[model samples]
Target: MSIIPSIFGGRRSSIFDPFSLDIWDPFREFPIPSSSDLSNETSALVNARVDWKETPEAHIFKADLPGIKKEELKVEVEDGNVLQIFGERNVEKEDKNDKWHRVERSSGRFTRRFRLPENAKMEEVKAAMENGVLTITVPKTEAKKTDVKSVEIKSLESYIQVLIDVLTAETRQNRVTPLVSVYEESCYRKISSEFL
Candidate 1:
């Protein structure tokens, strides 16, 4: 006979839900929490947020981790590319007489992974924690220079002409004209300055 009572099981929902806002409370005059606030709280409960920066020599990462001890944190590189930061925070035990109204602080294991760039030096990575913040440094490898040596050259025809002049001078001095074969001339024609 009553659809609303049957659907809701005769129990009113809190103002956190839009459908439950039908029954307003005069005592509850506080503003409703926004979606952004909920998201921020959720992120805070999960992995700590990090800031990444690239410098001339290295890549740096800074993560905010409040109320976490240095012994609980672990930083490592996996598969030569992934940088992993993992840690855990335990909830403090309450006394027998104390009552908790709300528990918003997160207490669990959290992990954050980042893909390192090609130039990052995985072997030389360093990490430090200070003032509730963890900082990681990944140095970059020095660039390699080409080892190829350059050679100078003139035109192919000019090179052949100089050879001919040398041969002519030798022939004149020796009174013997060394035979210049047609094959040699053909080979010289096919040769280019780039080869030299």
Candidate 2:
């Protein structure tokens, strides 16, 4: 009924042992498998789902971590821009004979990380878990203007192409061309006729 893994005990032998040939031994010396690897093999592991919301003042994240105890949960802020939530739930069953038809739920460690907004205030962050829902609130910090910027200059080639496109589109409609395009075309035609 113990949840811990069972350990088998046996005598060790060297290759020089005459009576007990270590080479013929059933249990060969090998490195013990790590507990993390064993935990990964276990079929029961927890899965967490998360929901995010953004507001003008703050961004909120609501995560669903079912079957996990509050004591097992860990929450922390990382890298000044990320909030990490992780936890593990251990379920021990004494009845080994009972058969399980379907085991869809996870039962191990679960984690969820969220990126904070640029204006997020790390000091005012808060988290609460209720009914398997973990809600993390990060308040928005006041944004300061980095530097004064100038307006981008439009390329003359693109500007002229845009003007031609508008004029072409207006002419394709078979209706009267717009006064702006007509004036522009007449001006260009007059300049070209004078040059010719």
The C-alpha lDDT values of all candidates are 0.78, 0.69
RMSD of 2: 17.0
For residues 154-180, write the lDDT of model 2, one tens digit per residue.
765555556767787877795545776
What TM-score does each of the candidates earn?
0.60, 0.46
Off by over 4 Å in 1: 1-40, 159-196
- The residue-level lDDT of candidate 1 at 94 comes to 84
Least well predicted 10-residue stretch by lDDT in candidate 2: 21-30
lDDT of 1 at 10: 52
**CA lDDT, candidate 1, residue 190:** 66
RMSD (Å) of each candidate, 1 decimal? 9.8, 17.0
lDDT by residue for model 1 over 53-148, one digit each (tens)?
A: 999899999999998888989999999989999988887998999866545566777899999989999999999999999999999988778799
Score residue 193 of candidate 1 by CA lDDT: 38
Residue pairs clashing in model 2 are 44-107, 45-106, 45-107, 45-108, 46-106, 46-107, 46-108
